[model samples]
Target: MNIITLYHGSGGKGTHELIDNIFYKYFYNKILDQQGDSSIINNINGRIAITTDSYVIEPIFFPGGDIGKLSVCGTVNDLAVVGAIPLYLTAGFIIEEGFDVNDLEKIAISMANAAKKAGVKIIAGDTKVVEKGKGDKIYINTAGIGSLRNDVNLGIANIEVGDKIIVSGTLGDHGTAILCKRQDLNFETEIESDCNALNGLIEEILNSKLKIRFMRDITRGGLATVLNEITNHREQGILLDQNCIPVREEVSGVCEILGVDPLYIANEGRVLVVVASEHSEKVLDIIRNNPLGKEAAVIGEVVKDKYGRVLLQTNIRGTRILDMAEAEIIPRIC
Candidate 1:
């Protein structure tokens, strides 16, 4: 039996067998697998936004979303965060041979729905099949390209000390949902995945009367990690009121029981926006009215700080530091 015993990476017969049997079979797409030293790609007009990601989410199916939707939404968000309007995407899949085709089709449909919502096209894709027990039921790798428009320059450097931080909804739902699915943990209220495309939010910001300095979707490392990354570009500190932060009761309860900080949890549908202090209210208002951002709120503000740290303004009216974790608080949940 050609059971992969984790030596697939070894340069031996088993590795070759796995590669030849699985990868080459399903991943047969045009303009790929060529032995050329470099690929000849046609050129277009403006700068291209490129982002790649691999999905290995445990359980594959969860409360609010599955790996398929996450794969698409995650790619679209990556492009949107950089001020690029996503245009095209490519999906590459590695599937276990005995995996259920009906489940795979459901995933594909969910992915298609997500792409439609984001207004991007899956122009090209490849698929491969592996022997059972060799690979997980499925893993998806996505590469996307988008065109960055003129007059839309946004990045961490654009973030100023006085900028306001806006969150597009509640946090910790996605993480808690996956955790519940993983351990069969039950709760009074089911935690749903926040996996959704932020394209509409970005579109509204671009087309509407609001101005944004910078934006990031709170994902893997969560809101605190994202803000910390921005602080690296400038000497900015973030101050947030613990009570002002919008979190669902169920999510908070799960976090409390699990001893996990909700701020460190992942969110797929939510986004963090840094708006210029002058236009903070308008931006927040626009976000709050949008379909994807109805629960939005101004969570914090950038500050001038020697510490260049993130502080939590506790309900007791005291300040405490929030530091990034060296190891992941939750693993394989995204």
Candidate 2:
């Protein structure tokens, strides 16, 4: 019997094998070895950006984008979240022995086009082949490096009480779309992953508001995980107005039916922003003008609280704890 099973996608035992055998080994530069959520590369002549991620979404193809397009955009968006001018990317591929060459060509072309759209280049890459069953059709690992604008200093440390929190667009599209594709679930409204590159939107916001405190792409763990990260660190609570949070009816219906929370579902093309209250409108305008952030909205605020927690105020004016979900959602989701 093949020891390989679906469990490999879990964040537990099988995930450890995949990371240890493939990811950590090949990506084992001294910098990544440090493992600080993201890689910290030195020798950056000026402001620098670095991000690393792996893509193993099931089915490889989706409604709006493919794994290839996702690989490029994902890297660019990571740098964008940091207020960086994304300029370069590195893609690594692990292909099973009997994969499709024509499809691989399509994947490569899509990546190239995505990089071009994001105004970046794929400067370096690596490829490997594995035994058929040991690997999926193909897995992509991407690492990106970009230069930050000298004037922009976006980070979690910039978050503060009274700062307004914003979401670039609607939520739960990515996870719902992927789940829909993998399973037989059907609905009147189809939700496509908001897969996109946000460098342009970031650039627009930076030009308009230099004081923008923090920004992050709502990726695997979605908006909730990101907000929790800040609360856990700053010892401040994030209070979100239920009405202010943007969600398409399709996405909301899907979540309600499937027992998932839109807040925790993955979002590919959305950004979470924390900025000064007074400048929130200015930042919002900059985002609205950009195509990537047209649906941008002010969703929440940072507040003084005894507990470092994230709370959601419902439409009924009641507050509930928005805790992180324990189960691995949409495994290999990134």
Candidate 3:
């Protein structure tokens, strides 16, 4: 009974006990505690943004965060990038039979803490148990709903040739952290995953007078993939300065040893922002003042190109095409 069993997933006493003891205990709220099939929320007005994402990260537990935290942050950041104020979340868990109860509790606690930090409530959730061999130790899916700011208008269509491209901080921290942990590679220095909810940092930028043309969280395919997505449907391309882009020395060392490009590596807490050229400095200052954006830098600018390509100007006197990754360099890294 200490560990999850098949019976816990059945709609019976075991299931009820698991819900009341774990899910409800950590995600207790006026709406969630009601234990209704669907939560009824009121006082919602204006535009609403909803985002859902699933987390199947291997090792579940990493140096800086676990799957639980990742699940909440993944969805919250998605909403934030769209100029939304996250309000509620629903978490779904698929746990393997024989998974440790303590580990499950730890994950639940992490989710609760992350939700609280992002100022969002977990209003509903579901848990299911699968055969040990058929499933990883645990997988998490989270859906978030938020209200959009009326003054905010952000999208790829708003991107122009003179717009500035800004990155919140250093790249490849999360990917490198997971890679090292998964491979059990011990280097001279340690790297921790930058898995965090970016709502607070994003809110500051949204509230300011800076013109935010477009924004996205640097996730699965890293900064390169995100920029490619922005330029995919447009006639403009992105030109990045290699020297201005922030990459930690430790992360650079790891990527160099592994022959991986940090541009294509994953990041959980970083954001890519495109803003008006006139407001670029103000936006950069705002982001740099925030703790999450201390390393924020203007790495690139949009350009009119026949093909919507991404080019990286190296610190040396060479330029290289930073194309979308043909295949996943590191899979299940988010």
TM-score, every prediction: 0.86, 0.85, 0.98
Ranking by TM-score: 3, 1, 2
In TM-score terms, which candidate is top?
A: 3
Error of 2 at 80 (Å): 1.2
Q: Candidate 1's residue-wise lDDT over 1-334, tens digit each?
A: 3333435434466545654554333333333355233333457468989999998888899988999899999999999988888876778777775677557767777887787778876655555667777788889998888888666878777787888898999988898898888889997779998899998788778665455788889998788788788776457789988887899999889888888888988888888988988988888788888887888888899999876899989999999887765565788876
Q: How accurate is candidate 1 locally (lDDT)?
A: 0.79
Residue pairs of candidate 2 with colliding backbone atoms: none
User: Backbone clash tally for model 3?
Assistant: 0
Superposed on all Cα atoms, model 3 deviates from the true structure by an RMSD in Å of: 0.9
Report each candidate's C-alpha RMSD, comma-separated, in the order given.
Answer: 4.9, 8.0, 0.9
Per-residue error for 42 in candidate 2, Å, reads 15
**Candidate 3 runs further than 4 Å off:** none
209: Cα error in model 3, Å: 2.1
For lDDT, candidate 2 versus 3, the one ahead is 3
Candidate lDDT scores, in order, read 0.79, 0.80, 0.92
Candidate 2 lDDT, 187-245, residue by residue in tens: 77666889999888888888875579988889878888888887885578999999999
Give lDDT for model 2. Answer: 0.80
